[model samples]
Target: MPVLIAIVAVGIVVVVLVVHLTGGSHTAKIANEDAAVERFLIDYPDVEVRQCFLSWDRRDAVLELEDGQVGLVHAVGVNFLTRLVKRGEMTARAGVSDESAVDLETGDVAWPRARMHFADSAMARTVVALFDKKVDTTDNKRAA
Candidate 1:
């Protein structure tokens, strides 16, 4: 029965795929503040990093750079994306999120928005404050 054999083969393939995906989930994370800073500097050299605010799960990060530039790094599946965004490129809100969460709505399509949860409520609000700074709209280029 060819149909019976095909069904068995399909089932085997599905089982293998499921196992592979779930078993390989030591999924990438930023690990710590230094690692987050390292990842961003690797992409955009020549910029000075003043401070870092990372998520509790180590999957998101916010960097304070020289001249008031901001860097965003967040995990997407097993990979991470880093961006040097301008002030108006996104919005951050603390009240709407959980007590320890900071919500960011970045206008970029690749990584439009992210909700980063911190262990401290104060840190969450501080992250939101980073987006509140005022600056010239034309001073910097779009995030890389």
Candidate 2:
């Protein structure tokens, strides 16, 4: 009887986990990230965004690329982010640097806001997706 109870409990826990993993919120988050990455790509056809690193805690996404560069993206409609900006904790800027500044006569204007930083694994996924490259969805392996 005890063994049966243990098995049942384990099975229930497994089902709950599976359900949570395949839930709507998780799918929406991934879809949003994918959409944002695609938008960034369309905005900057010349530059490539490779790997996407998503952090649920920070509520932000970072893209890693081949050329040893990273792009940080701030999630839209984040209440904390809005509050931070209002509280003077965050400031809005045009570009990370003026070197790769996008202009109507020069760079693509469709890009929302992109800033270049040191390349990291997370950013690579986004850049890869930006160029329509295969994204590494696995958690352990970094882009090769």
Candidate 3:
């Protein structure tokens, strides 16, 4: 009984040490625009990154690709989740708690949505605009 108890105690200590050493509490961040671009490119090496913008909390990175395709890099558990989003695929809006934050919904089954917090409302709106789809009024017009 004494030896079993000792072994259990040492095992618990080892587990705790491993977690602490391996950054168990670490929260992933986008770091910067360049970092965000690089991270996105890793999963999509064929595409070129024109520009990138980081959210206020550094939890999200919104990128503009060379072909006008939009991409997103979201921090998840010390890693990044990257996706290429087509125009009009997402709906962006501000969160209830923060005006400087944008909530995005892509209607994707696996990766449905994300939230980005910006430094200001303007930045938030800019992110929202990226996802906005404009109506082509000319297509709906009838020749009288």
Best by TM-score: 1
TM-score, cand. 2: 0.30
Worst 10 residues of 2 by lDDT: 80-89
Query: Highest lDDT, which number?
Result: 1
lDDT of 2 by residue, 86-118 (tens): 111122222234422211111324433434332
Instruction: Give me the overall lDDT of model 3.
Output: 0.83
Each prediction's number of clashing residue pairs: 0, 16, 0
Q: Candidate 1 at residue 108, lDDT? A: 75
RMSD, every candidate, angstroms: 6.3, 16.9, 5.2
List, residue by residue over 1-144, the lDDT tens digit for candidate 3: 999999999999999999989898688998789889888889999999877779988989888776667899998888889999877878888778888888898798877877788889888877777666763345348643
**Candidate 1 least-lDDT 10 residues:** 135-144
In order, candidate lDDTs are 0.84, 0.42, 0.83
Model 1 lDDT tens row, 1-144: 999999999999998889778865556888899999998988988889989998999999999887687998888778788889776568988956387898888887866777889989999977887788675446365542
Q: Which should have the higher lDDT, number 1 or number 2?
A: 1
